[model samples]
Target: MFFTDSRLHFFRPLVGKYREVVVECVRLLYQKLYTDLTGYGQSHGRDFVIDVFVEAIARAPLLDEEVGAPEGRFKDARALAGFILNNLLDNGWMERRLDEATLQSHYGFTRMGRGFAQPFVESGKLEYRSRNRNTRNTRNSLQAFAEKGEVYDLLDALEYSERIISDFADTIAELEERRLQLVREVESRQLIEQAADQFFDFIDTVFKPDLEVRLSADSVEKYRDQIASLIRQVRRRRKYGEGEHAELLWQTVMEMRLRKLLPGRVVEGQSLLENIVHTIEERLQSACDIMLPALRRALNSFTARADIIIRQLSYLHRQADEPLLDACSRLREMSPDNQEQALQRMGQVLAGVRSGWPASEQFVLRSRNRRRTVRATLANAPGLDRDAQKAQFISQVLDQAFHVSSQHIRAYVSDKLITQGRVYSKHLAVQDARQLLALAHVVSLAGERLDNGFEILIHPARSDSAGLQVFEASNCGDGYFDSRENFELELVDRQRAS
Candidate 1:
């Protein structure tokens, strides 16, 4: 349908011999009519448009090959400007309308003309506007729909979701372009200073303001959960709507379709609202799971390329600064025979010369002593019988099982203290050799802090006579031990102790 528009024939000027001049003129015209803010006038007259066109023609450099002989009426800049203007007016790129208030004919760009001319104006300019806000805006719009139940908010959210992925794709493309440009510069031998300037210019203009924010706070992944929840809420809320709201939304969607605002065919059984919701969800998922990683990779590649360029530039700079390096490089480039001859000459020149300070110690000539070699012999150990091996393993197992570690001590004390709230050394159940050994360790550990939220307190025995205060520990055929129970164990919590 767009290609069928008669005004698209205006593109003929762009492809003809005067394409450069036409592009320049269009850019200038767009800037004056829309982008330029210096003037307060709402519209431009025919004379003003012709003057702007004349300025563009003068600024443009048309080559001899492109500037063939023209008609007599379009020989000069003003005449050419007039001819171009007439062509634009005939093709609907611009229109001349009389204003009732001013009673004067004012020249203005048509809607299609303004839309087409935007790219001409924006071409070759670095976009500094932050693109990272789309994801956040999408989240906010969804949240508004969830809270306020507005169908327009959902529409706005769908638009923002589409923009988010496009923005990331554009960002990655821009980085790739910049990286390639740097590579070209490096290949062209635009060394250290120029490369450094370009690298930092990219960083200051694009990276810090946009890409950094995109990867961090405004990341799609960061808001994915909230957006998903809000989408679910909006969908759930819309399902319950019966009469007015649903009809209003359907009518609005149809209106948008008529206006060509909503692109693509709607599914047979699906409403536009459902289609929009599904699209938003899919776009968000693709952005988080696919586009975000691609963006990260692009950024890393750009950085790595920049690093390599700087390193190469630095190396070249060093080679330029250092004469010795230059000489070495020349020598390397020389033939083998020539290089050998040059080395021999240098060696002859430096044969008797010393470059550093003399050594503090006098040089002494000493006889060299040869080291005696010793051959390693294999060790022949006697193998033990099965009975001996079994006995040895049993002993090791017993030793490890009854080992008096802090864990064993804590477990034994905790088990005793759980019911009684306190444990005494004399009253400790010495059921076997392990218990007998635990009792000895428990007495030794008295008055110390155990990290199991408890402490051990020792109380002196009442009687000094060993016979009455002696506590004996015996096991059934395992082992036995006896000790004077000179102290009592009390379990105090570390909190109370503190």
Candidate 2:
């Protein structure tokens, strides 16, 4: 707690005056509490500050193993804490407050304490964590807005979608601009080599990490789905003219016009919702400008330069080649005959560039004008006439259902039955209520009615002790057993004459 009384004074020092102490204090706190739980001094060893130092060093063995324990540094843990606390407290980096309920002094970080500790934390020696944006939730919200065909919902979806596309373009543009800055900063080849470390660090630590998250396949797929769904929903509602809030928006706009405040008024005869859709579509379509061939060429050139430098570094670490080996052999045998051989070997080593192997040239060509084959043409084609088709199809279905011999002569029914209702001398048997209904459709289509005395039967299928029922029976020979299905249907009704 701070007081405005004249006796109360807040002493804040420049970070440079006590930066090292601040860093040490924070490191000790993390090492003792979080990283190195064993670093705390025991009650008996509290006065032995050397043991505390030893414990602290032991906890962070990898980074602080070289730090030796200091002897005769402090009286006890209480005294040591007081000394460190006073320095931190004096600098306004920490605060000590008396709790009203507990009546005990509580030590906690002040604004300065958190501000000073950030650098140590960001050093990445203590901990590391990566957080990605919750793009899925954001996209889902936008999709919901699009699906709900209200004026405000459509407006919200439009704004959200536009932001996503614009943000993508902005990030890529920023990276392109940063890459250009290297030219002004780098003067010579040595400078370029020096800048390479910083450049690659920025790419790896900042640029690439961010871009990877933003362009993750899952996020991209969800984003595309959301955008496509929004587009479809918007167009669908517009076509149907069935949004709930359109009337409300129209009234609001009219009110604005009455007041001479022409908000969202367009010259074209389009509602505010329709204009918003058009604007969103145009922005999204143009968002791909960053990925166009022209910009891609520039990006490729930058990558090519970086690759050349990387390859050059690899070449420096490479082993001696055959030409160098030959040169060494000639030099070792210093004879007159070896002089010409040494010259030839030296020439081979100096002629660094070589033609690529001829066998490596392989590629497949795809014509730009190649047409896509229509594989679904069969589904789209018109089929045989509906009337004759329905009769033939129903007859075949009945044959499969009954499994009866053709000697009954019911199988000889013609397609003419589908076109004209006729009084037949014979009856058609249907196995179940479902089949009876199916057969009724065809009979109804023929505009024929059943005779006054018609028989229709339905019964449960035969079931064993296991409760397993046989729903179908097949005819093996001239004789087929009586069907024992859920329902046996004898077609009793037909279409009446029109």
Best by lDDT: 1
314 in model 1: Cα distance from truth in Å? 1.7
How much lDDT does each candidate structure score? 0.76, 0.49
lDDT of 1 by residue, 1-498 (tens): 664555767666665556678788888988887775325655588888898999999988774444454423456898989888887887768888998987999887888888988988777455666678999999999888667656678788989999998998898898899888888877766454687788988898888888889889899889999988877765552232445445455335433542364446555555676677779999999998899999989989999988887788778877789976776888999999999998898789769987887686877779999999887998889999999999999999988986887667667767767777775565666576666677667766666775677777766656655443554445222335544454566778888667
**Scored by Cα lDDT, where does model 1 land?**
0.76
Point out the worst 10-residue segment of candidate 1 by lDDT.
470-479
Clashing pairs in 2: 431-488, 431-489, 448-494, 448-495
Model 2 off-target regions past 4 Å? 1-14, 17-21, 27-87, 111-133, 144-213, 216-306, 317-498
lDDT of 2 by residue, 1-498 (tens): 453332133333223333344355555554443354434443212233334434443443222212332222455445544555565566566666786885766555566566656566556362323423434433455466555434554555556656656556655675577566665545455555555676687667754666557556324443655666656654552332335545444434433332343363655455554565567656545544443333445556666656655665455445235556665665878887878776787788779867876674476666799798877755566778999899999999987775533222223333323333332311334555543444333322222223553222233334566453433345311123243323222333323311
Per-candidate clashes, comma-separated: 0, 4
Residue 470 in candidate 2, Cα distance off native in Å? 98
